[model samples]
Target: MEDDALILDLQPLPDGIDERLAAQLTFIAEADRLKTVLRASPLAAADRRENDAEHSWHLALMVVLLAEYADAPIDVGHAVKLVVVHDLVEVYAGDSPVYDPQAVLDQQAREEAAADRLFSLLPADQAREIRELWDEFEAGATPEARFGKGIDRLQPMLLNWLAGGGTWSMPGATEARVRAREAGVVAASAALGDAAGLMVDEGVRRGWIRTSEG
Candidate 1:
């Protein structure tokens, strides 16, 4: 609530803001571009697609609320940081939905370049901190990172089910593919994973999600 001073769209910045703070402010302002990076997943309303900012915020919230269900003990704050920074690269690289077959092409190069450009807007130490968090999230090796990932995978699936199979109805988004994509998160958190599995099953029964057989 008190961080309004950091919001670039708002009038004049705080008095005595230093060069370091100025850079940080600039990065924050630029990161706001994420709001324009639309995702394949639509909102529960199905009226419009959600943006990267909405996805990141929702992903962080999901991690916080579902921390208790993680398969291993996790630092919730660490997980939140991971989710918040993970997608910031999309501001520059643009979003490529995972189910998109073309998404894999040069994604790492694009995102890495985006990260360098965006995070560099912040002071050195701060940039390193965020970049490290982003890398950890990408690695998905740490317990916290894995849990963060599980929630990331779960968020859109929940939205899809709520939006009457939003992206699940896409030609490439078959039941088998969706289930396999969701399985990674299920391995990370039993409770949330179980819920995801059930939702996929219901989606199939509702004819919202299709199978190869069909």
Candidate 2:
């Protein structure tokens, strides 16, 4: 996309503010946009869709409380950080529904562009740091990232169970399909995975989620 095509929020910087502070403040304000980006999953206890900001916040708290159950040792702090920024790009590119393959298509390219546009609101060094964190979360290569990824998947599955089959009750959400989608939850922590697996089984038994195709 062309630079001219990008509409920026240009407001007067506070007098005598340093370049770094100005840029950081701008990025902070821009992050507020995340509150408006709705996601596919509904809030577990609420009647409405969850936004990117709420999802990130939920994951951050989950990471702290559930860190102990991780398959391998992880830096809890780092894992929390990964979850917080993982969905920041959704502010620009919007949330992608995992069950909808079309939504996930070109996901990387779209998110990278959003990351560049959003993270660049910070100073150069901070931009690089924030972008690297976003990349690490996306890669899910490191222990922290993998654990974060696991928690990310677990949250939605739990929501579906809590919401009487929430998104999973929608078309195309078969038992086998959901299991495949949630493999990462188990990969992150066996205990949580086992618990979620049992819930999925119940969901299938209750006819809230479909079983394998005949």
Candidate 3:
């Protein structure tokens, strides 16, 4: 409880701040526009450009509505917090295509740096809490992370299927793309798999998606 004792125990960020890091604070405000500017994942509706903040709102809403489908019991409140803050980094890092191979490879570096910078803007304790939640979401280790990821995968799959396979019909969409985008959720929850399968089936039945050629 003493000041000197606290200083002895306290640690600094794993990666210290720099000029590039400092600019991230101003960019964090752009997260408020995500819903309006960024589209859902490419598997979903490509026509819409949902901004970053809106995407977070939708993810939090999904966490609330779909908590029962989680593979294990979860603190939905914690899951909501994770989802709400997960992409706030995008306010600085910018959204990348989920299926873009090169983009996917580069994503972690870009986002990790963004996370370090954006979360540091808050008061020390609050910054740590938000950064830790963001890390938990990224690690995908806990029940909450798995459940949060399940919804994350499910939403775009559902949206794409509903939108008549908006991006799925593009020339390069392969079974591999579908698998890559949706498989993590399948691994996380059976109910999510079932829901995603139903969406895919509906997309085909409605002539929105073509079955793969032999």
Candidate 4:
């Protein structure tokens, strides 16, 4: 028989405590690196480049504020989630300027590998959820994904316009190319697309972006 006065030496932790907590904490810590991943787009009034984390935050806010502009009914919460997690892989894959032709060549493969490594840092369920969100945004199949993609394209274009054609000054940045790339914005939101078109025309007039024939 066991002694009534016997005391337990060490207490056992609750079930799944260490494994779950460790995975979550590790993922959170890894996500912090996104703050250092600088993008090609500059801040509206500032000279410094924007980081991926800041870009994601801005997109999340845009999702909330601009959901009404989406062409179809959408789940705003789901859209916000998609934008916030969409660029986490950029932390590992690094940013390629929108007009960089060489960089765009293998961009998908590079980002896919980055997504695998970054999302796998989380617990299995969480990893699967985030990877799926990232995939949806890439596919742009759903109304929400299309809206998210439009917002993503519009933000940098707006920033370039506001910065007085910051990156648009690149030689490859032609009015035709800009319009071609931003067609998705029109597909998702006509009003926003029209606004974007005006900005591009203004950039061309200002000689910030070159004319197609130039």
TM-score each candidate.
0.90, 0.92, 0.76, 0.89
Per-residue accuracy of model 4 over 1-214 as CA lDDT, tens digit each: 1321111212333467688886777677667778989988889967798999999999989889999988899999999999998998877788877777887788899999989888887899999999999999999999999999999989999889889987787767778789886797998898889888888888889888887744
Relative to the true structure, candidate 3 has a C-alpha RMSD (angstroms) of 9.6
lDDT of 3 at 143: 91
After the best TM-score superposition of candidate 3, give how far the Cα of residue 30 lies from its true spot, in angstroms.
5.5
lDDT of 3: 0.70
Clashing pairs in 1: none
Location of the lowest summed lDDT over 10 successive residues in candidate 3: 3-12
Better of 1 and 4 by lDDT: 1
| Location of the lowest summed lDDT over 10 successive residues in candidate 1 | 1-10
Looking at model 2, which ten-residue stretch has the lowest summed lDDT? 1-10
Tell me which of candidates 2 and 4 scores higher on TM-score.
2
Task: Report the lDDT tens digits of candidate 2 across residue range 119-180.
Answer: 88888998888888899998989989998999899888888888888888666677878998
Off by over 4 Å in 2: 1-11, 212-214
Backbone clashes counted, model 1: 0
Residue 178 lDDT, candidate 4, scale 0-100:
90
Model 1 has an lDDT value of 0.87
